[model samples]
Target: MLLFDFMFSETLNASLVQSSLVCLATFSAIIWWLRPSRSRSLPPGPRGWPILGYLPNIKFSEWCNGYQTHDVMCKLAEKYGAVFGLKIGSKDVLVLNDYESIKEAFHHTNMNDRPENAMIKNIDNLGTGILFSCGDKWKEIRKFTITKLKSFGIGKRSFAENITIEAECLNSEIAKIQGNPFYSRPLLEPATLNVISSILLGQRFSYDDEELHFILDNLHRNGKVVGSGGALLFVPSLQIFLKDKIKEYRHNLDVVLKYFRGIVSKHQEEFDPYIEKDYIDAYISEMRHNKDKGKQSYLDVSNLVMTLGNLFAAGSFTTSETLSWAILYLTKHPEIQKRAQEEIDNVLNQNQPRLEDKPSLPYTWAVVLETMRLATVGPLGVTHAVADDTRMFGCEIPKGTMIMPNLWNVHHDPALWSEPNEFKPERFLNENGQVEEPPQLIPFGTGRRSCPGEQLGKMELFIFITHLLQKFNFKEAEGESPLTLEGSLGLTWSPTPYHVCAHSRE
Candidate 1:
């Protein structure tokens, strides 16, 4: 009887211990779920799920609901104010929604670094390019690239002749369609690419060049893939599940890189320091000079390849896409197109548009500015990072925090633009009937890290738009659905594929 009593006591003790442990676990979980998510130092934002944070929300909204990443961010900003915080995976993301916030944050020296995320690191393993590199390397390469490109007539009036030549080529391509409805990207992209190519590769590719077509095809495809799969960069653990997408992204990037590598190799073989033919030749000369000095420098073969890749990708894609958006908008709004053409006609008198004629054509320039504002191609801009723990706009941003400048928000902000959704070129004009670009019109971003190609891009826009409008009238295709201004987000916010009838103005 005593032994039986002891056995019962032991069984009861075990049950009590097990029950206590279960309760403790349940209580702990509740505390974790209900914990104060907002750090006193951080900006206000949603209290997302434990561990995963706001990543799932972003993915679901983008994948399931067809919302663009920028659209999702704008919605969050509506609730959280201009400065919002989010914990994306293991990183802290601070999104600057207003022009003030973006301007201050981008100009801050400490806030100038690029995110050293897995995906970014994978793109240029050496981290040698101007777009993604930080610190001295970026500064050195950027300065050199800018100086060299200028010498090659990138931003100067001398380059206007080359652009005019390319514009003529594009005009011929469009004229081939003979007023039939056609997609503009195929013609526009190559024309823009050739302009940049003259500076970078020192030669132009014929429209039917097999190699150029292959590179362009891959580059365009990768832009879309990056938009859809870019979240993987923020939450790398998800890569395991989305291996196929990651693989495709890598493959596309690899194909482009392979072509660039061959070009770089050919340049190296034919490199002559005394005679600099193009940007590549100038870079090789610099590399050799550094070598001759026995100096440890970032100007090496790897850096050159990656820098060229960055230049080629950025130099062509954004400008071409912006032009595509311009054409789409003009096609949809024929009145705007006619007015712009009239302004061009009045200014140029049937002559090819020149860079110097920009000031003389206020309405046409306004049209370009308006298109840039409405389209907001790089909607999210480039993701920035804090080099150290810093305070920005009354929030304590942690070191290595990911900074997202929601260019879309700033462009579409009701406070900044009247009827922000509508296309109004006059918004860019003042009472004086001259072009007036407000400080808020930051289509290529602003501050130190703004696009180096800004001037060149503007030059391209002015030259191409004026020339195109001078020679042709763009309108919606007959028997086709109206083109929507709503753009699909990729590496850029590009117009949906639509056919435009380009009738000869002559």
Candidate 2:
């Protein structure tokens, strides 16, 4: 009995020793993981607990959330100056609130590459689509796209011809409303979608078509998902644990990618390189040619799919939002609207307003400028990641730091503009009554990764505004506030749903 008891005690002692050793190993592992890497030094900001980072502080509600993000970052800028740090789940992002810091980080070539985020990779893999690609691949593809866009009539006669058709269609649709308070989605979406569709697929859909509706809805939803809670993308392992949200994201991407794939597959069977018809056909031909020569090409089938996706999604949102805001503002300020109409009518004299006419109609241009400033989409824009450790505004931003350019802060900065909150077009006009472009209104962002679609976007806005204002006087629906500027946060800031009645100039 004595011997058995001693043996039992020895076994118990061994077990306790093993448990203590295991605890020590686990504690050491935690310490090692939390310890900052010896590679590079990072900028300073609020510290977070291990693993989760500052994600707990991220509020996801749309209305309060966007403002909260803007305000919090602004406060941090006050405390930390232009450059500061933020953590979203084990990841640190350096936020750039002022123009000087933004230019230093974004405009310089060293900081040009896209960040190493899973979502960015997912986007790149799903389609080395223009929005997410980096390096020589990006430069080659972008150069090709720029060349193609220009050749196909960006700032050329072909583009003008297409815009005229879309303008006519938009005008005809508005005329159908007969001066009633009709929701403009049916008319506006098709017009905007076709601007891209004609460029990409060489096709256009009627506003009432079911397929177009489905595509638009899916695009809209995907944009919302990507723009919000997209930080989920950076932590892919969480996808396995949080299966439902990732599944939804996958489903949305699959739906759009599948649609694009179908288009590409059809083009592959019947595409003609010699013809050089539409964007996809040109890409398909290029892809095949590269494959034959054993040279890697950016215009692969996946890229074609994503390129169309990027073109459709990116092109549609900002233009639509800007137009929506312009209409709303005109409705609120009737006198300004009247003056714009007068300028369009007097300058063009029943002729379609050309791009060159933009200079002649200073007030008309001012209205567009004000719309851009007041309704800057992506108030936060897309979150950009640092390519490497860098300094901005005297702060140390480590490599792999995500950069958020606060375009909202830039557009609304009281230091830059007088009465920053007011919707004043006159601010953009010089004492000489000419439209003076301000570098401070950075609606399109700046630097190596700035938006490539700026000229197209500006053209679309000018054409749409010219046609709409010339034909109809926008007015508030009864008992509605025309000055109401509510935006739902997404990959872009979109106006909250509202209706404006079109009063015909007839």
lDDT of each: 0.80, 0.72
lDDT of 2 by residue, 1-506 (tens): 00000001122357665885477457646875666422224566665434445543444221345544565667667887766676655677667788877877788775676555464453445666776677777787887787777777888766877877888898898888888887765577788888878888888888788878878888876665555556655544333334555556678878888988988788878876688788888787777788899997667777778778878887876787788888878888999999999989999898887777778889988999898988777676666766666665565667666667877778887899889878899999888999889887788889888877888888888888898988899888887655467765566666777888898887
**Steric clash pairs (candidate 1):** none
Report the CA-based lDDT of candidate 2 relative to the real structure.
0.72
Residue 230, candidate 1: Cα error in Å is 1.9
Off by over 4 Å in 2: 1-40, 60-68, 117-125, 235-242, 480-483
Root-mean-square deviation of Cα positions for candidate 2 versus the true structure, in angstroms: 10.7
Each model's RMSD to truth, in Å? 10.9, 10.7
* Residues 104-145, model 1: lDDT tens digits: 989989988876645545554444578778888888999999
Taking the candidates one at a time, how many backbone clashes does each contain? 0, 2
Looking at candidate 2, the ten consecutive residues that score lowest on lDDT are: 1-10
* Candidate 1 CA-lDDT value: 0.80
